[model samples]
Target: MEIDEKDERIDKIDQILNDEIDIDVNQEGEEAEFSSLQDKYQINSGEALNSSDIYRIAAKESTRMIVLVGPVASGKTTMETSLYQLFQNSPVNDFCFAGSYSLQGFEQRAFYTRIKSKGNEPTTQRTSLEDNQAFLHIRLWNRNNNVISNLILADISGEAFTNHIGQVDEAKISFPFIERADYVVGIIDGEKLCNKKTRNSIVSEMIEMIRTFWDAELITDGCVLQIVFSKFDLFSKVENHNLILEKIKQQIVARLSELFMDIEYYNVAAMPSTIDEFSVGYGLEDLLQGWVRKHVRKSSRKMEEPFDELTEYDRLYYKFLGELNE
Candidate 1:
């Protein structure tokens, strides 16, 4: 009888062990399902995106590409970061900051300028030519039309273009994205413009950069050219600021009038040295407004159906390309 009881107890223990094994398997199955769901709904990685990444976003949205062209220390990155910083406080030119895929990228660039950095003066980190990603993206919501638009700003290192000053063929090979850009912004350094020594050379270099791009056919007639003077507050401090600005404008117009259909000029002090005198992001609202206005006009046009043979990404790209050409 004792031996029979022992065998019965052993059988009961096996049964409990089997039940625990079943529970463990069920838990693992549930965990696997949760992981699958997480993969399906993964969020943006919050880093600067590459061409493939931007193409993916463009495929699903109405996208506009803005390429900032300038030499080093010309305030290209500053303008971008200032625009992002502006949205943190309030809407800019009626466009609310809807979202950004590159929050970390913008934040990293803007951090040094913030008071938290413990710096004596606000300074922007220079973009390197060797950086893997060149594009930073933001989604803006227009309060007037209740429409959302995607803006992809190319933050390529200024050295990329400055290095290939007269090398049109090399520039063409390197900057293929310029062909697809809706707006090509040429940044003028206001601090350099203020100085008598570097002023003429700075202007000439800018003009030549544009000319090189035009010769390469990278900046076709479809792209709008925006001549932006960055750090305008410093330039304004100089005597005869108005006359200087007019002369510069006349020079640019005389040189580039035939190349582009629309050319606009803006003066922005993204981060002014004299904060008491000039506000941060001075004149940036007008810049934002100009872009939004153009976007609205483009969106109003009728879109033709994309060719069936093209892939989804190609279809979207070509569709926008056609619109810009028109």
Candidate 2:
């Protein structure tokens, strides 16, 4: 009965999520491009989708603008890299534009990467991201068939988030392509969750920024927010997985629920830096893992581990975020 009920829920989810978002169909190169992709990647049967299928569908039909928002060193870039790969390695083709930039005097940077099936990879060589003057730029097409394209993962520095109130006006400044986003990726720092005062502070600030953005009308789609609790490597090494998941969710439900009328949250951990291999974890019920340790006052801790469970977590995170609209 449990399995049956779960299956029923999944079906309802599928029905609500099968169609692409109601985008501005009139935008130049938008409808024609998506229509071209739909022609090639349309699903025909009731068979459930595999990871590859999810990647393919997202690659072809995803014409949405995405932005990554989180604390400094919260692994936004890593998540972005993995998500790009999750789509790229899938049987479905996805395209990405690596050209990213930043405005001077502003601590933040802007990048434009199109998320679509493999269409064509950018040919030009790009400069390193650390070179404040240079941006990590490339325009890639990862689709061989129909192609769906939209900008991905571009933003300013953590200071853009840190110096919020003092620089709130500058925060409103065009930091990146986020001024009009269809998707907002919020990466949460796990170790921070263990700390009570810090956790609440972190959550409050994020909620405020999001509220500020929404009220300001800078976003094209405030409907979806993909809240990712990244750096699970340190989290599991310190506490029990089940307990951690529940607490994490509760924190999110308490703090972030106000940001959106509908929301989806995911606890994600990337490959442990200690491990030479790559992995991911997803779908754990968030339980408060434990009280913050007396020794670790730092918000983020780098821990070593023998790992398993970290691949496909963040993308599945995206899959569920899409569920919010349902």
C-alpha TM-scores of all predictions: 0.79, 0.47
Q: List the residue pairs that clash in candidate 1.
A: none
Per-residue alpha-carbon lDDT of candidate 2 for residues 60-175, written as tens digits (9 for 90 to 100)? 54434446676676666554444433433433223433322211211121122222333252111122223333111113444544343433334335545555533445556644
* 101-207: candidate 1 lDDT, tens digit per residue: 99999998999999999999999899978997878999999998999889899998988879989899998988988887888899999999989999989999999
Q: How many backbone clashes does candidate 1 have?
A: 0
Q: Among these predicted structures, which one has the highest lDDT?
A: 1
* Deviating ranges (above 4 Å) for candidate 1: 1-40, 295-326
Angstrom error of the Cα, residue 114, model 2: value is 24
Count of residue pairs whose backbone atoms collide, per candidate: 0, 43
